[model samples]
Target: MNSESLVKPCSYDPSFKVDIRSHEPLWCCAMTSSDVLVEMSALLSQLESICRKENEPSSQVSQQTGGKRKRHYSNTFQNHGMVLIERMTNLLQKTMSPVPTLLEYLESNSCAILFPRAVLYVKNPTAKHTPIKRAPMDGYFSQATALNQLISLCHQLQHDVTTMTNHKYIAHQIALLYQSINQLGNPKVLLDHRTSIETTFKKIKAELEKEGEKAPCLNSELIFWLQNLTSSLVQSVKTLSAELTSQMRPAMKYILQSTT
Candidate 1:
């Protein structure tokens, strides 16, 4: 499926109410391996786009003294680059089982990582390098990794929305999260997350309306509300991951026996 199709429109009605406490089993319908593969590919494509946009030069200006031109990115772009770097580093650190060789390679070739920081003046020699050429060991691992990244992004979005005091970026983050969840190929989980996010968006809208300010900064109440929403999202994703692992154990065991 096209990755763009996974992103839901951010429009919502303030009157909408979402019931997040559904009794559906977390493992109601697990995605098949092929479905997982497609979703993972879509997610990787989205991540690659983000990395590309992050490093794209914002503007270029001629030098005052010389004819040379210098490339510079806006503060917003730089801040995003830093955040991407931080997310990647966090993912590496939080890996449940780390390979020493892989860690060494990533550290030694920082510029070649999946999401390298934006370099203003210097050109990256490994700009064309693609790190994740092939799929990971299994679809389960890929889905788990994507879910972890989604959870991390949710936390970052919460921090950014609260500290930045602006809800403008929240829509984009929600869209990305929706895309990630959609790629998981679990319709029920995706619907749950989408409902929760839309509910939160409406709450934010109501809060803004209460202050009679268009584009108003998020207040303390909204901040706490967002915190709870993000916590719920993280917990839901974790539960899904655990359920996925549980469902795949039999297949994993069969593969191991066959290989042995």
Candidate 2:
């Protein structure tokens, strides 16, 4: 049987009812033996014809793939080729009878190693720059309420995340980071979280404010805890910064570009 993913006569068939599963790419060894030869021969044969006519031995005819020799392609020719490949890929994706989203494909088939891919095109997107979908709750006294919730959580946190993978510290730090990210959904929540963080620092200072001898081990432990929290906060801010640059900036650019 022809291997090269077999061009599955199943789903693609105009007669047969397409199995939705078949829309997902089946893993197969790259076009092997005769298949590669057949495709290459077809492509090269077409390429040779174009080269022969354009070169003409006696004189060089002007070629779309800019070069005196007619066979050699320049950077501009390669750029156009890339653009053509991208356009064709997009067109094929759209034209397919049944297509799976990238996320859908990712959900299945963990055994196979998949190449990382990213697509960034704005067809229709919300213009809102802020995270509106999951903003902190609103009420008569939301400001202090949210602030208190975060600070209380901070007070309760003693690197405690026993629920994840039977680990204590690693998962605990990640959970704290997650909470910080969730809090960032609202500008006020982010501000509140930061303010609560300062309260945490102040508490440490208040404890250390006692005069005379400070226990070395106790002071060291507090220092380590503070370092971890500070590092997590910095890392979170860095992530938000990059998100602003990559996602928000491009979105705004697209808005302006389309408008102009």
Candidate 3:
């Protein structure tokens, strides 16, 4: 099944209680309690065996001796890990108690989901920022959602500055992105250096545009100055993006490895 399909709709109550029966109900296939326990036990045992094999000292002995594992073995291990991850995630969805719904669990681990999307946006600059279009802007649902939007806008701002000739238009979009980021707030506790950059950006835009009004066209000198300004702004956004990712990565790693 598609991964997107696996994410069931979560209904919320005003009192902040989860209707667990409705959340991911499809996963609760009719089965006797004993049968479910047996199946879960077997799957857990198999997963443990695979993990043990992967973690064995002998496995690292090859690497320590400057010898790589055989290609087939490496592929097999990776496939096993993927299968186990899917199974475990499914099991968690199926078995979660109302005390902590899957949505709650996922929200607590929002950084896990956010960091990967952030990395994809940063590492692949040319890739389409698909999540940004549908991301929640309210900033209350999840930090991950807002970060997705911010990252996409940051990329768009960079692209616009580099490819668009209209400095005013690019600056306007940059201002919008900055405002969105500020409204989103820093849930990940990233060191905020954006205030100074944002101030500089506004000052530069105001000064440059005022000066440009005196000239009939954006001359070579003005163009050079605009290019430098755009470059600096892009760099500032990129720096913040990287710092936020770095702050969340450790938590993300823990969440990814979670079996419960």
Candidate 4:
């Protein structure tokens, strides 16, 4: 029998189906913020680790030396490869599937990691079906919200730069920063810094593009890219903080200006 025929087909248990109808929308108009970006980041790392472990060869010696395996041993590796492919495919699908609530998304087992603490903004789906009472914004104004988001974006960027394993994830992080800056009206000071940031990001992006979607190796150039990227992000955050301080306290701005 051919190697393909000798391998047994893998089976998987069906994922649990979430019943949206049974779950009422919890405060459709309410918006709750949490520091879940970093948590989600950690979850992504865990997923990558699992994928690597699953796809790894069963025997290092067999892989390195090209030694002949007994028929039964060969079969075991074949079975494992087949099962790993199926599991990884299912995981990809699950992670891509959209859910309304953070809780439901986690329960879906898309990530297949235990997320004990996730900071998330639970978006309500019921608002699409009907109008609901809007949440109060007494302490949460537009500028304040945008500033907070930018700060969070900087943190995410820094995290991605420091722990960059997959190029695709890093690309997503860069895109988030670009989108947020644009949404914030592309303030002049931020726009100036963005040029420097984008320059560093593009160099890293080019290197990653050449390497394709695999774990990156740390080289001197790559380290330099990461350091420059981190520095740019820190500068961006500082710029925003200063602007926010000026807006919140005009006297501070005047005092700093007079001192300068």
**Pairs of colliding residues, candidate 4:** 36-119
- Predicted structure with the largest TM-score when compared to the true one: 1
Error of 1 at 132 (Å): 19
- For each candidate, what is the lDDT? 0.52, 0.37, 0.47, 0.46
Q: lDDT by residue for model 3 over 1-260, one digit each (tens)?
A: 64557668778758886544332336556654344334443443354344434433443335544785422135676565555444545655444354343233335544224333332322333343333322111122344545666666666755655566665565566567667667555523322435544555655466447753643234455445445544554454455454445444544444345433
lDDT (tens digit, per residue) of candidate 2 on 1-260: 85687465545656766544432336644543234223322232232223223223325555654654333334553343344334323333432257544334223322011111111011111121221222111121233344345444544443332222222243344346446446435453246445555456554545545566343122545546655665455444445354323323433343344335
How well is each residue in 103-218 modelled by candidate 1, as lDDT tens digits? Answer: 34344434222223222111332343333332222244566677777788888977787667557556566678767766666645456667777677776656555555656666
**Which residue pairs in candidate 1 have backbone atoms (N, alpha carbon, C) closer than 3 angstroms, thus clashing?**
none
TM-score of each: 0.37, 0.22, 0.33, 0.35
Which 10 consecutive positions of candidate 3 have the poorest summed lDDT?
132-141
Q: In candidate 2, where is summed lDDT lowest over 10 consecutive residues?
A: 111-120
Clashing pairs in 2: none
lDDT at residue 205 of model 1 (Cα atoms): 56
lDDT of 3 at 59: 33
Which residue pairs show backbone clashes in model 3? none
TM-score attained by model 3: 0.33
lDDT of 2: 0.37
